[model samples]
Target: MAVDPDKAVLQELARRNPGEPFVMLNLLRFAADGRASYEEYSRRAAAFLRQYGGELLYAGDGNEALVAEEGQAWDAVLLVRYPSREAFSRMVTDPGYREISRLRSRALAEAVLQPTTPWTRRAG
Candidate 1:
């Protein structure tokens, strides 16, 4: 039930190719009656996202998993792209953004924030 990133997580992210763009995959499981709070958090977070050169590529509620172990389905999924890992790290640590982050923490019982690197495609 990790609702927020810890120091080690942020440190690791900063240690990576800090200037490389990346997409973050968010898997969220809400607490009871948590959706409303999360919605508010999303609204407030948009400004910070924009300020940090982040974009919301996709967001959708989860449906039947089709293939997963029991209890594996999430309540929602979000894909957010950032210009660089450093930008993301900065955004999350900003004092202003930190104020509204409580809404996100309270809204989720569990969450997964995984950063992904795009694979280079070969020309045909």
Candidate 2:
């Protein structure tokens, strides 16, 4: 399970310009008594998000899964939308944001951070 994205992932993200906003889907598994830590991180991250033109779309604790594998249910889920990939990249690389991320790292047992690009169906 990856808690953070690596340089390779960053590089790949950098190469893509979908010409649309990017929203990250966070699937989280908390460590023992880790919600508090994640809350701290989220509190700290709120400022950075505003500074970088990003917003927390939704954040909620997960519950029953209507469909999925037995172990596939997440402890929490978050949707964060960024103005652009460059803005997101900048935020991730920011020294201040990195410090805030420490709390998030400590709070999570595992996480899947997937960036979603909005797209509309093309009809002919």
Candidate 3:
């Protein structure tokens, strides 16, 4: 249940982007009574996210999964799209955002933050 990204992860994310838009998929496992704190975090984090060309595509409590393994169910799901990986990295690394990140840390027992790229047909 790693909530924070390390230097290595940031480095890899930085290396991979060519300025293309990317979406982040977040799967959250909240601790007891963690939802309120997470909501607060989200409310405050929205400004910082927007400053870096990021948008909250969706954020909602997770419902029954049509398919999943045991222990794979998440409490909430969040989808955010960023103009680029650099923008996202900068947003996370910003001092203002860092200050408010504690709320997110306190709210989740486990979480998944994955970057997704849109698919396109390849030319033959």
Candidate 4:
């Protein structure tokens, strides 16, 4: 597949909105026994998010820079920034997303979603 650098840039811009209410949906897939089909799932998930207006500020498999200290502990780490909280919710529940849910579930033994609000610094 041809990689659209423009799309990636736009997505990254959207994702890097520092003051926005971003949700860090950390998916901790249960795969302690063995490795899941993370590579495939990660590719698909990136494509899926790009279809919408999502920027991937960060992506790694533990060993990469900016990743957690306890690297390799997770099969994957994805960060997507939406325009709004509702937008995030709708994206998950959307018909298009419904199909991808299976891909997500199948790739991991289990998972976790951790939503967070991006901290904003006020000008003095």
Candidate 5:
């Protein structure tokens, strides 16, 4: 299971929308005894998030899925909005942030970090 973004994907993410504000969807599955580590990571990462204009809109523990295939429920979910893709890229690459990122890596058994573009309303 993939837990972190690679350089290639981060580059691709920046190239796609370097200037547009976007939200990141985080689907996390914790490793054994991982939640505590992840909480610590979140605490440390808050400073970086503020430094780079990232806002955590929502975070919640997952409950039983009302509708989903087997093995589809996540352990936690987070919606984080960034000023732009570049800001997100910068945050991840920052040396300070990188130092603490290991906590996140050890905390998750698997993760999905997806960038989301808001939909525009269509004129009727």
Candidate 6:
């Protein structure tokens, strides 16, 4: 049977935070062999996020990120925190962020962005 990757990720997240209003942002950046510039791209991405008052909770690279049950085929992953989903969207659509995104696109082979909004469940 084929596993629904999105479901799996969401289930894993629900197990961790059963009743919390949180958003999970997953970034997948694949780099060309021996030509990937993750270091530079990550620095710029980090800076762009910082400008919007984004708090980076965690950062993972190809090595460590590969352990995600989905496996780390990506060059990097970043976990960031924001007050709300609208806020996150605003940050991405910001004019300054658009310019930074251009540089990011050039530094990676591919990028996948996932935004997850969680529901808070009340316990009996």
Who wins the lDDT comparison? 5
How many steric overlaps does candidate 6 have?
1
Weakest 10 consecutive residues of candidate 4 by summed lDDT: 1-10
Off by over 4 Å in 1: 122-124
TM-score of each: 0.96, 0.93, 0.94, 0.58, 0.98, 0.57
Q: List the residue pairs that clash in candidate 4.
A: 11-55, 30-110
- lDDT head-to-head 2 vs 4, winner: 2
Provide the clash count, candidate 1: 0
The best candidate by TM-score is: 5
Residue 122 displacement in candidate 1 (angstroms): 4.3
lDDT tens readout by residue for model 2, 1-124? 6798998898778679834578999999999999999999998999999998999999998999999998999999999999888888888899999988999999999999999977888997
Instruction: Give the clash count for each candidate.
Output: 0, 0, 0, 2, 0, 1
Model 1 lDDT, residue 116, Cα: 96
Residue pair clashes in candidate 1: none
lDDT of 1: 0.96
Clashing pairs in 5: none
> Per-residue lDDT of 2-111 in model 6, one digit per residue for the tens?
11134455455445545443445656555454224545555676776666556777777656543566644666676777555445555666687666665556566555
Higher-TM-score candidate of 1 and 5: 5
Per-residue lDDT for 45 in model 4?
66
lDDT of 6 at 32: 52
Reference-based lDDT, each prediction: 0.96, 0.90, 0.91, 0.55, 0.97, 0.56
Sort every candidate by TM-score, greatest first: 5, 1, 3, 2, 4, 6
